[model samples]
Target: MRKYGRTDEASSALAVQLRSYPANERTHYKHAVHQHFSHRNEPLTKEDITQALCQLNGQKGGNKS
Candidate 1:
């Protein structure tokens, strides 16, 4: 199962849309979830989102055979 909290059609569509963004522009999963809900007051800045994704991508790939 996907680790992210959401699994609805709109979330799925957003995931697809996010894929088209360059890695630098891609928002982190946490931020995406936060933005999805209206309760949060201060959204993350663009730099923070980019940094989060960059850090995530920096980890070693786990697809070894």
Candidate 2:
């Protein structure tokens, strides 16, 4: 079964999305997540959401082979 914690859910979805894209695109996504989460107390923009998704994808991949 998939372990679905609040943080896990976000990263899991990001990983699936990353599998659909090329390597270079993943970097942009990672940067966005880092920027947004780093300043999470502030408002998130559309770009921030996009970035978070990217970051999640990369993080998920790192956990696997």
Candidate 3:
């Protein structure tokens, strides 16, 4: 709740994605995600994901207040 903002879905997409990983790879992927989000001071909101995707595609997201 703190790291990622409220999701509209009934279940977490992140959990579903993680579960798709092979059993041997789950631990490694989980640890990597934790390490990445743990350092972020602000919660990861939908807007954050959108911005990330935009940046990934080499486009800049509009500024937010």
Candidate 4:
């Protein structure tokens, strides 16, 4: 099971969309969920989102033997 939250069509679509973006413009799961619910009053900025993206993206590829 996915650790982040529930797995649904909307979240799957957003994950695909977010993965398509360059790491510089990637969105965070938390922030994405917040925005999805129109939580504009959340205490977070665009920079934080991008940072989370970079961090997660950085783990995408590796040789596991």
Against the true structure, what is each candidate's TM-score?
A: 0.34, 0.43, 0.45, 0.33
Regions of model 1 farther than 4 Å from truth: 1-7, 28-33, 40-65
lDDT of each: 0.49, 0.56, 0.48, 0.50
Off by over 4 Å in 3: 1-11, 45-65
Tens digits of lDDT, candidate 3, 1-65: 64533354412544555566679866665455544456676555545444443343343225443
Model 1 over residues 1-65: C-alpha lDDT tens digits? 23333346545555565686677655665464444443434443444445544454455344345
Stretches of candidate 2 off by over 4 Å are 1-6, 41-65
Ranking 3 against 4 by lDDT, winner: 4
Top candidate when judged by lDDT against the true structure: 2
By TM-score, highest first, what's the ranking?
3, 2, 1, 4
Residue pair clashes in candidate 3: none
Poorest stretch of ten by lDDT in candidate 4: 36-45
Rank candidates by lDDT, best first: 2, 4, 1, 3
Note each model's CA RMSD in angstroms: 10.3, 10.6, 8.7, 10.8
**lDDT by residue (tens digit), candidate 4, 1-65:** 34443346545555665876667655555465544445334343444445544555555544334
Q: What is the lDDT of residue 65 in candidate 3?
A: 32
Model 2 lowest lDDT segment of ten: 1-10
lDDT of 2 by residue, 1-65 (tens): 22222254456555566666789777676455555566344444445456667457568676453
- TM value for model 4: 0.33
The C-alpha stretches of model 4 lying farther than 4 A from their native spots are: 1-7, 28-33, 39-65
